[model samples]
Target: MSPFQPWAHGLNEIRFQGGAEGFSREALSELLENVPLAIAVTLGPQQIFAFANRLFRSAMGMADEDLIGRTVSDVMGDRYTPEIRALRQRVFETGEPQELKDASLMLTPGTTTYWDIKLLPVRGGEDQISGILALAANVTERVRARSEADLQAREAALHNERLALAVEATELGLWEWNARTGEIFWSERQKEIFGLPKNEPATYEFWLSAIHPEDRERVVGGVGALSDPRSGGGLHAEHRVVHRNGDVRWIVSRGRMLYEVVDGELRPSRLLGTIIDITDRRRDEEVRQLLVQELNHRVKNLFAMTSGMVALTARTAETPKQMAAALRGRIEALARAHELIRPAITGSEPSDGETSVAGIVEAILAPHVNQGSPSQMTFEGPSLRIGPKAATILTLVLHELATNASKYGALSVPDGHLRITWIKGAMLTLLWQEEKGPTISGPPKAEGFGSQLARRSVTDQLGGAIAYDWRPEGLQVRIDLPLSQLNA
Candidate 1:
């Protein structure tokens, strides 16, 4: 027989005609002792605990003899709050059963338990409810299981939200395809990655149509291989796509397959992947590689030009001092021009066709301006900017002038000074004037490479006119060039 058989038999016996007038005290005692559920009886507003079964006494860590006829507040102390007393009182007044699931019960400061409680009113012969009878079953394990499940669900949702935020912030598109069902799920970013309008139905056909004709077969083959059960760990592929507007883009897809068993056969079920747009990044890398190759070629060409200049200068010099001086001046001018063009050649801002005249002048004159005695040089100009070619030519012209002053003109004398100035007019006028220098009588008996190159650079290369005046105390040179040509 079950442990509750005695209680059930007693109640059934009392219901039958000609049965015992009331419960047998001995049988009632035996029934309470054998029942596994805890039982308690309380009476009146004071909540006097009239009776408690063995299970109830044991659960409360007390003896039945000591608990009998004691007030609930006196037995349970602060643990029996007013709210719980009110709930018990309502059950006694209504003469109905009040069930509570997973009610928490505190037995000690550190020990607690959960219960499934049923409170039923016990009535007297007059039909007036006189006491409350409570049946409580321990439900701690079930409550703990439910609480853990709720926490797991919350943690899973938080993880998914974090993954979604990461994908959106990186502008990556996610996709999942159920191979067996032929169903595809695409993230919102996937549509945007393909440059497609949102809210448009994204079907397999729509995506396949966007793939470039040349790449469609390859993409399909890669996907098939990745999803094949016989094939391995994962799959990765890069392909091109043609947008609706006919713009081409590069895309990289990476994914892994999940498998399931059906009919005793392991079959591929889904493919989960991410798609990244790499068109811009790929183009930038290609451009950088090309620029590196171009820079190497330019450096080799510059070396060859320097070698040729050295040979020409060596053959024309009549003495060691003359050759040394010529080499120094020519190399200095070349170095200055190189400094002006280096940034442009490397694809930095103010590149070829976009450099400024004022910027060029400042870059070239920076070295001289830092000297302790910089009174030897002065420059004045209007606000102006010119293209790389014009800037380069102007840098060379100024270099030649400065080199001449340092070697044989105004700057060669301790008290001498050189004034370089420019003005904007119908055309641009630039002047290089020297003061406090040895008197300039005329040209050298034979023109040197510097003078010849200076004249050619201004007149032929720059398409500008030049005038040289040999004065008793100093020299003055003037140049005029079209502003439009210089800016271009």
Candidate 2:
């Protein structure tokens, strides 16, 4: 027989008769003792315990003490507030059922439990309510599980919010696509990256169209591979985009595809990614590459010029000492010119810390200008930013001219003045004139190595023209150079 069989039989008999009045107290007590629920009966306004089953006594922490005639508050302690007493009184007077769901119950000082409680009014033979019957079921585990889930949801929300703030601070553009709905979502920065207006709706077609024609095929193929299960890792692509404003910019994109099983086959369900503008970095890289090539070309030219100078000096010198002196002077002149070009080529700053035409001229003539009063040499022109290659060629040409004037022209004698001036328009025109210097009978019959090199640099390398006029008082040289070549 089941352990509850005897109690079940008596309880069934009392319930069959529809009331507890006819049953013996011993029979009723035995029936309630073996029941699963926490059951109790309280009488009068003080809610004095008339009967408490084994489960009820255990829940109230009064299993070893007498519970009969004890008030509900006196047994359950302070956690049972006045509101509970009022609720019991109302239930008894109205002869109605009342309930509390997931209510906290503290049976000990430091321990708490939850329960769902129902209070039904028990009546006497006259049908007048005499007591309240309480039934309780523990719900502590269920309430704790729900509270834990709520906490996790809040933490996840906070984490996502922080991640979004970090992404915005870094200026990254975010995008998401849903394959099932064919819908796309773009953050504001994403739209700005593509140069799209706020009102414009972003679509997959528009994205593909924005990519430069040369890179569209490759980018599309990479993105398409995200759907293939065989392909591992996320999508990473660096390509060029033609903005709505017709400006081409470089961008890098990284993303992963989300997949779900459909009909036993894994298929892509969503795509999410971020984009970063890399136009400035790409341009800097290109400039560095151009600088390397220009440096190599300039080194080769320097060697060729040095070889020619050696051969020419050997022919003219009557002695080895004279040849060495000429070659040393020429090499020193080249070194002075290179001092101006070094900053630009090596990515350092010159003394004046400038990379313009005026900066270059001021640096090269600093030595000569310090020797005489400022009035002896004057410069007049607007400053233009020139690249390393332009600065190198211009430095060599100017250095050669200055050396020639110091040796044989205006700078050779005191009281001789040299003025340099330039004007910019369709092209750059410069004048190097000397006054009050040794009279010039005529131009040299044969072109020297310095003159040949200077002419070649101005015309061939700089795509400019040079002319020398042997005036009676002094020599005047005119040079006209293209603006494009100078900037390059």
lDDT string for model 1 (15-110, tens) is: 323336655656676777768798887877676887788888988889988898898888877777676677787776776566666778887568
lDDT of 2 by residue, 328-352 (tens): 8777767756776777778886775
Clashes of each: 2, 0
Q: C-alpha displacement of 213 in model 1, angstroms?
A: 4.3
Question: Which runs of model 2 end up more than 4 angstroms from their true locations?
Answer: 1-41, 51-58, 61-65, 82-102, 108-110, 116-137, 165-171, 197-199, 258-260, 314-326, 355-359, 362-376, 379-386, 422-429, 481-487
Give the TM-score of each candidate: 0.62, 0.78
Error of 1 at 80 (Å): 2.2
Top-TM-score structure, candidate number? 2
* Residues forming the 10-long window of minimal summed lDDT in candidate 1: 1-10
TM-score of 1: 0.62
Which number leads on lDDT? 2
